[model samples]
Each structure stands twice: as C-alpha cells, then as structure tokens.
Target: MAPEPEEKDGEFVSTGSVLRQVLFGLVVAFSTLMTGFTSAWPVVLPKLQENPRSFNVTDQDVAWLVSVQGIVGMCTSLLSGHMVEYFGPRKLLLINLFPTFGLWLLMAFTSFLSVLYLCRIGLCISTYIIKSFFQAYIAELCQAKIRGAIAALPELIISVGVLVIYILANFFSYEVVTALCAVPFLPLFFLAIFLPESPYWLMRRNRTDDVKASLQRLRGQRENVNNEVKVLTRTSKVQVSAWSQIHELRKRENILPILLVLSILSLREISGQTALFSYSVYMFRQAGVEMDAFLCTVLLGCVRVVTTIIAVPALDRAGRRPFLIGSSVICGTSQLVIGFTLLMEIPGASWVPLAGLLIYVAAFGLGQAGIPWILMGELLPTPVRSIGSSIITFTYCLLMFIVNYIFFWLLANIRLGGTLCLFAFANVILVIIAYFWLPETKGRSLENLEVAFVKRKRLDQNDHDSNHEVTIELPLS
Candidate 1:
C-alpha cells in the first residue's frame, strides 16, 4: 500500500471538517439550550410576579428564586473545572443534562418556594459545570487558528436559544415554555451518547489507542494524530495537579497575561451586560412599556439574537481588541444617553431608553458576550491552560454574582438612569484597560501567542536594563 499522505505543514485547518463541525454544532446546541433556559426566567418573571401566591411566594421571595441560581452558578465555577478535568467533559456534560432537564420539569409543577429555590440552584450548578467544561473542551479540540470562531459557536447558540424561548414564551403558557426549553436537551443527550471522549483527556491518561481514535474522529485523518497526541501528552505531564499548576502560574513572568485575562473577565461583568439580561423585563417596564413584560423581554432577546448573527462572520475579521474597544464605546455611550434621558425625564424618553438598551445589547453581543472565553483559551500556555482557565472563570463567575446581586439592589433604590450611568462608567474604564493591556490575538496561533508573551516580557526587561545602564553611566560621569 502507498504510504499515508503526510500532514501539511503550516496549513490552515478547516474548522468545518464534516465530523468536527457536526460535533461542535451539537455541543453548541446543548450550550445554547442551557443558556436559553437560564435566561428564559426574564420572560417568565412577570407571570411569577403577578401570581406569586400561585407558587406560594411573595414577589421578594420569587426574586430570590432567580437570584439564587446566579449565586449557585458563581460558587460552583471553580469546582466545575476540577470536576471536568477529573471526569472528562463528555461525562460531566451528560451528568449535567439530568438536572438541567429535571429542573425545568420541577419548575413546571412546583408550588413551593423552597422547591423552586432547590431546582434553580440545581440548574445553576449544572450550568456552571457544563459551561466550564464545554469551553475548555472546545479550546482543547479546535486548531489554534480557528479556535475563536469555534468558541463563538456557544454564544451564537445561546442567542438562538434566547430567541427561541422568547418566541415560545410569547405564545405559550409557562408550562409549555418549560417543556419546550427541555426539548433541546433530548437531542443533546442522544447525540452525546455516541460522541467520542475528548482526545486531550485521553492522551493525558495515556490511553494511546483511544486518543488516536478520538483524533481521527475529530480531525478526520490519522497522519497527524500521533503528533497531536505527543503535544497534549507533554502538556499534560507538566500539569500534574491543579494546585501545583496554579502556583506555577503565579510567577512574575505570567503576571501580564494573567492580569489581562482577569481584567477582561472582570470588566466583562462590571460592564453590566449580564445585569441587563437579568433585569431586562424590569428595565422595559420602567421605560413605560405598556405591553406584557414577557413580550417585551422576547423583543429584547430577538434583538440580541439578530445582532449576534450579524457579529459571527465579523468576529475573526474585525479582530478581538477592535471589537472590544468599539463595543465598549458604543455600550458606554448608550448607557450614558439612557441614564441622562431618565435623569432629565425627557419627553419620549421611553423610546430613548429603549433605543439605548438595544444598542447596549448589540454591543455586548458583538464583543463581551463571547470574547472573554475566547481570550481565556488563547492567553495561557498549554501546561497551565486548564488551571488558568478555571481561575479566569472563577473570577468571572464571582463578579457576575456580585454584579447581579448589587444590580437588583441598585434597581430598587437608584433611578434607572443612574443605574445605567454606573455601568457606562464601568465600560469606559474597560475601554481604557483594553487599549493599554489586551493584546490582539486574532489570526495568531496558540503557540505563537505563548512565544509572543515570552518575547514581550524579555523585550520589556531589555528596555529596563538599557535605561538602567544609561542612568548609571550619566551619574558616574
């Protein structure tokens, strides 16, 4: 038989390889379903608000039902990372699907606040687990050049789910909406049944044959499987344990990238996009929208979905930093306009707020929604990616919880304009941070980024040395 075709060197790997694309698409669908269901609360919030007693709850208690989910998700993010590494992404995801489906079923029938709280917490934990694992898995599986585009799949699916849920909620009962929310999970559960385990995980475990099979399935060729396996094996060997890996990352050399990732993730939350998602219905209500709150929320979700579609093709083309800085500016400006409109009580201010809100959502979809996860995957060296990703996600989730909690309190006490103005100021700060610190990773290979950081650090040190030498010579003279 003729020798197997040699793997191409420096060739572009197609993310659209039939099997990989299908697998990625399936993962995206599951992610979207999870996110969509979580976000669907906004559409259902008003009904829960109106009939609090139907669920044997006060409005304040019902608010906690939503709040608790975020709180639990935030708390679980760190643990979820370890769990993913230990059990593997496929297994963790399959486990999460159970509670994810169960929670919706519970919501459909529960009459007690305690039961509702428990189910929400369960859903939150499941979400945290799946999101952390899915992100890491996608990063590990995709070739560096196309990783960002593949990473964007989850966010795209999320928007789709949001749009679907919103539409369904507008025309259906809460029970029907919950049932519909659970439908996506059915396909996901079935599809996942036959999906291969993550090859990186298999390599790490020294399951050579299994690793080769996974690589063949994911990459659709056997020629490069051994090389890929070797790289992953070397990386895995270096990361013997999570804590040791994390400690290694604390060195001064790693500080810049670490700080950059943390800052981006932090600013992502402080930018107030998620707060808006959690409170969209309430904000629209404050804007003097007389329609049903659920309908308004569906409108907002539709806007988000449409804008996200507009963003996909542009993401790899526009580059990360440009979109981030541009979105920050747009988001900040929109918030300022909306805040001032509320403050001045301008006539037709309702439309002004509505327009501002739409702009804010659009900007968020264009940048902050997916970019942080993409950056997290790209910023770290292979040896520490898992631990580093966990830390970044932990910071992100913690900040999300704090923001959402404070958001509810702020909305209760502060005027709508003031609340938005605060977020605008936060976005302005993020723009400055992005300008000075966040590097452009677009089109750069992961190995190239690793080298770039090292080279940058070395260059910085050399400049410092030259400046010191010049100062010493002048003083001696």
Candidate 2:
C-alpha cells in the first residue's frame, strides 16, 4: 500500500476538491439508504402477524422473512469482494440494484410472504455487495484527514432511510411503501453512471489515462493530481494472490486488526439493537406503554438520525478510539438503566427505555457505528482488502441473522430486562477490551496505521528481551 499522504489531514481541508469527493461518496452511499429501510421493514412484520388476512401470512411465515435476509446477506458478502475487484465497484453497484428494484416490484404488486422473503433477500444481498465497494471506495477516494466524516456517511443515510420507511409505513399500505423504497434506485444508479470509478481500480487495470482523469475530477482541476497518481500506480501492481492474503493473517499486524474488526462487528450486530428497532412497537406494547407504537418508532428513527449527524464531525476531530469506548460505556449504562427501570417496575418511568435508548444510539452513532467500517478498509492491505472485507461483512451478516432470529426467545426465556442487562455488561467488557486493542485511525493514513501496529509489536518484543536479560543476570548473581 502507498505511504500516508504527506499533508496528513490536508486532503480536503486545504483543497477545493473535497466537494467532488463528498458528492461521489453521497452517490455511492445511497445504498445504505436501502439498507436502512430493509432494517426498518422488520418493524412492519409484527403488524403483518397481527392482521394476517390483509397479507395472507402466518406468524411462522413472518418470522422467516427476517432471518432469510441475513442468511442471503451472509452469502452475498462473501462474494462481494471478488465481484467488486473484478467487475469494478461502479458496475457492481449499478447491477446489484437491479435485484433490489425487482424485489420491490414484487412487493408492490403482491403480498405473499414469499415475496417479502425475496424482497428482503434482494435488499440484503445488494446491500452487502454495495457495502464492500463503498468501504473500498471511501478509503481510496478521500484523504485520511477527512475519511472519518465520509465513512460515517452511511450511518446518517441509514437513519434517514429508516425514518422515511417508518413514517411511510404508518400512512401507506405495504405495497405503496415498498414501491417508495424501490423508486430511489432508478435515479441513484443512473447518477452513478456519470461518477468517476475508483482511481485505484483504474490504476490496477493499468488504465493510466482514466486514473489521471479520475484524479483530476476528485482532487480538482487546479490541484496537483500527479503525486496521488504515483501512489495508486505503486500500490495496485501485480495483485497479491489469495494464498498470500491467507498467509498475511499469520502476521501480528494482519491478525490483530481482523480480530478487532470481528469483535466490533459481532458486538454491534448481536447486541439486539436490530431487535430493539424491529420490535420497538411490540416491546412498548408488552411493557404497557400508552402512546402509539408507530409514533414511538418514528421517534426512535429521528433519534438515530440526529445522533449520527453529531458523530460525523467528531469522527475526524476527536479520533476513533474514544468514540468506541465512550459509546460503549454510554450504551452499556443506558442498557443498565433500562434493565433496572423495567425490573423495578418504576412508576411513571415508561419513558425510561426511550431515554436510555436515545443516549445509547447517540453514543453508538458518535463512535462504534462508523469506526469498525473505517478500520475494515484501513487495517487490511490492498492485496488482502477484498477478502478481509468479505470475511468481516459475512460474519457481520451471519451474526445479525442469528441475533434477529433468537432475540425474542432470549426476551421470553430470560426476560427483557435480563437480556438487555447482558448486552449492557457486554458493552462494558468491550469498552475495556477496545481501549487496549483498538488503534486510533482518525486523520491517519491507512498505511501508517498498519505500520503503527508493527512498530508497537517490535517495541513490545524488545522490552521482553530486556526483561529476560535482567532475569538471567539475577540468576548469575
């Protein structure tokens, strides 16, 4: 991989080019909008179960609609890395949306539970494919200094998508709401056609002229694109074989980051937050909330959006490790607060879960939400990036499916308060672990971050040697 940009944080800060990079990110990031809605659609499932005649589905049928998406997503994520690397990010993103558009067409015209299953399958499969590309895209296009804000773009887009779905599901029939979901892909996909392909990918193909043009567009006409061009050329040659990538994991640097990526992805997805989002209405109903469940869900979506907006700027300025630690502590505390309030049956504190969840998600938005993704792309070398992203995203989807499938069982078997408390305790543990393992990547180049781990490991070994010599000296005396 190329060395860190000399300007460090100057990629966007000093240039007029940031706007072009931002626009490019927004277009690519649009898929997360689809992802947000797909995540939100589960909330509608409980309603479907309540009134089967309108949808011709059973509780069992409704249950499969969600778990199946995760299963499909897991499978899709594994392949997405190769798809993007070979076919290219721009084309993969465009083609992948067809399945999403087609699925939504099914949803708008039919109410069969089977169609919902297909809708979810296409939605999730397309999403992970887009995500693999987006991660690579953001890492390559933007400078390190501003990468955090761009990387966090998904969280904000997703929140907006969820809020839109929640509100639409309230007034519209399922069919109409689905059609609304499908509508955006048409314009977004076309807009992407005009956008520059990843300059790195272009360079990898030895398409030097295209790379030059792409850099000109992204870095601005007046800015010097030649140095950026050299980095891409140097980094993309003679792509590393898959065997070498697998071998790379044996190294301390490779292993540590991947492990950190795995832990962070697993913790968030399996945290029952999706269940928290999906079953918000049911959760409130079961808890005897007097307010409208739909309205409360809309409120939840709003909280997510607002907090993510707050997080975007801080990602670059405050650094990544703090957000991960702070978000975990706050989320853990919020979960604890919710658990206590519910178990104690506090009078007139029906709003406690709402308040706690608000804080939890806000904290999550500020750090945990964006850092894992940034690390996923940054930590892995270019040769291993594709496979590494695939593994992490695949693990993420599989865990998400498992959590969604079993969350209710946990709530029933252990009680909502107990289940939440467990997640709370987990966040506390993660906060401790993350403090030691999570490297600070904010405003630093990906190559520099990787080398930092290697340097730390080297220093640690030297310290160990010094200690061993002292022990030997003591024995001689």
Judging by lDDT against the true structure, name the best candidate. 2
Model 2 misplaced stretches (Cα beyond 4 Å): 1-7, 10-15, 45-55, 111-116, 205-209, 234-237, 346-348, 456-477
Clash pairs detected, candidate 1:
none
Candidate 1 local lDDT, residue 16: 49
What's the alpha carbon RMSD for model 2? Answer: 6.4
TM-score for each model:
0.85, 0.87
- State the displacement of the C-alpha of residue 186, model 2, in Å, after optimal TM-score superposition: 0.6
**TM-score of structure candidate 1:** 0.85
Model 1: worst 10 consecutive residues (lDDT sum): 468-477
lDDT of 2: 0.72
